[model samples]
Target: MNILLAVLTSAIAVGGTLIGSWSTYLFQRRTAERAEAVNREERLRQERLAAFSTYAAAVTELKRGLITLWFRRRRALRDQDTREELQAAQLDSDRLGAAAEAAAFRLRLVADDPGLRPLMTAISTHLGAISHAADRQAVIAIEARFEEAVTAFIDAAAARVQ
Candidate 1:
């Protein structure tokens, strides 16, 4: 009887150990899953932040190029060599605009907010206007509008990542 009692106690202890181990495994698995999910979200946030910043920088570069080309066009109207230089500047501006558009597309892919699309579109329109602006006054006015749209986008992006 004593032997049978010892065997039963040992079996109970073993079963309890197995249950404890299984519970611990399940708990650890859940914790790991949660951690993984948090990590994924953080990574996505970083990606979106990068995309937004890149797009912003590209837009700024394009704007600067357009402003430069506008001034060049005004000054180079009478000079043959300056006209060639202005043409080169225009080409560079075009390239910058294309790059900015590509960056915007990337931002669209990573942006979780649907509202940002319209803001981006508005910024693009302003940029287009700036590129084709005939005078310094028009460029200045369009630049102000572009800056506002950019600020709105930045604010929206900041809210999203937080």
Candidate 2:
């Protein structure tokens, strides 16, 4: 009887140790998975923030170039020297526009928000229209629209990143 009891006790002890070890392993695995998920979310948020910042800076620079181009075009009709300036302005504007478009595409790729596309398009459309404006007043009006679009985009992006 004593021998039988000792063997039974040993078996139960072994079974309990295995069960405890398995439970600990499961708990640790779950904790590691949760940590990994949190880290991934943080990394995505950082990427989105960087993309949004780059897009904003590129768009702002493009807006400045487009406005300069508008003034240069207006002056080119009356001044011979302004024609050269206008050509330079045109090149700058083209380069800036391409940069802004690239930034927008990057932002679009990183952003999960669907509404951002139209806002981004609106800004680009308005910025493009500035150079085609009939007068300074028209350019100013388009600039205002561009600012509004940018504001909308920034607000939306801010919400998404948070």
Candidate 3:
């Protein structure tokens, strides 16, 4: 009888120990998973903010270019300052496009929204047209299109920003 009681007690103790170990393991796993999930969310938020900064910088440059080009389009000798601004804007646009176009530019930004490309292309085309215009009408066309494209891009980017 004593032998039977001893074996039964030992068996119960071993079973309890196993249950305790399993519970502890599950608890630790859950905690780790929660921490990992929080980290991921934080990383994503930072990435978005970075991307926003890049896009905002690019848009500001683009607006400056548009202003310069528009104001100088009718001038007999294109303003040297405006020309410089155009060049700077172009460089900023390229840099932003590289990132807005991909993942690397964001403070850690992501997403591949292709709709933004057309606005950039339009701005470039219109700006280029101004340089090659043979007459006032041609210049006007460039002015109109450039403004339109810039406005559209700004609107879109603003929407995305908010």
Candidate 4:
């Protein structure tokens, strides 16, 4: 009888230990899963912010490039070389427009400011007018106007953001 009692107690002790270990394993697995989920969410948010920043930077670069080219060409430039550089700048501006549209749609960047859309439209129109001009003289006449418009845009954009 004593031997039988000892055997039963030993078996119960082993069973209890196994149950405790399984419970601990399950708890650890759940905690790890929760942590992974949180990490995934954080990474996704950061990716979105990064994408928005890239789009904004591209747009700024386009404006800066066009403005810089305008300034460079403004200084007693000959008709032939000025026209060539203007064409190149226009192409860069067009690419930036496409990127802006994509970013706005994909990232839902429709901000409260009404001027942003019009500014973009104006830039596109200015470039288009320059591109369609029949002669260098026509384009050269509007070069200063184009430069002023872009400068104003930058100023207004800064104010609006603030």
- Write the residue-wise lDDT of candidate 3 on 20-47 in tens digits: 9999999999999999999998776566
What digit string (tens of lDDT, one per residue) describes model 2 on residues 10-92? 99999999999999999999999999999999999999999998998899899999898878776777674556688899899
lDDT of each: 0.87, 0.88, 0.62, 0.62
Which candidate do you rate higher for lDDT, 1 or 3?
Answer: 1
Candidate 4, 1-162: lDDT as tens digits: 999999999999999999999999999999999999989877766655554455455555654555545554553255545666676766776676677667656544534346656665565566556545545576665555556665666666555434
Deviation (Å) of 29 in candidate 3: 1.0
> Which parts of model 1 have CA positions greater than 4 angstroms off?
80-83
Q: Which ten residues in a row have the lowest lDDT in candidate 3?
A: 100-109
Preferred candidate (TM-score higher): 1 or 2: 1
- On TM-score, the stronger of 3 and 4 is 4
What is candidate 4's local distance difference test score? 0.62
User: Model 3: residues >4 Å from true position, as ranges?
Assistant: 65-162
The pairs that clash in candidate 2 are: none
- Lowest summed-lDDT stretch of 10 residues in model 1? 74-83
At residue 2, what lDDT does model 1 achieve?
100
The predictions' CA RMSDs to the true structure, in order, are 1.7, 2.0, 6.2, 7.8
For candidate 3, list the clashing residue pairs, or say none.
106-109
User: How big is the positional error of residue 162 in model 2, measured in Å on the Cα after superposition?
Assistant: 1.9
Error of 3 at 3 (Å): 2.8
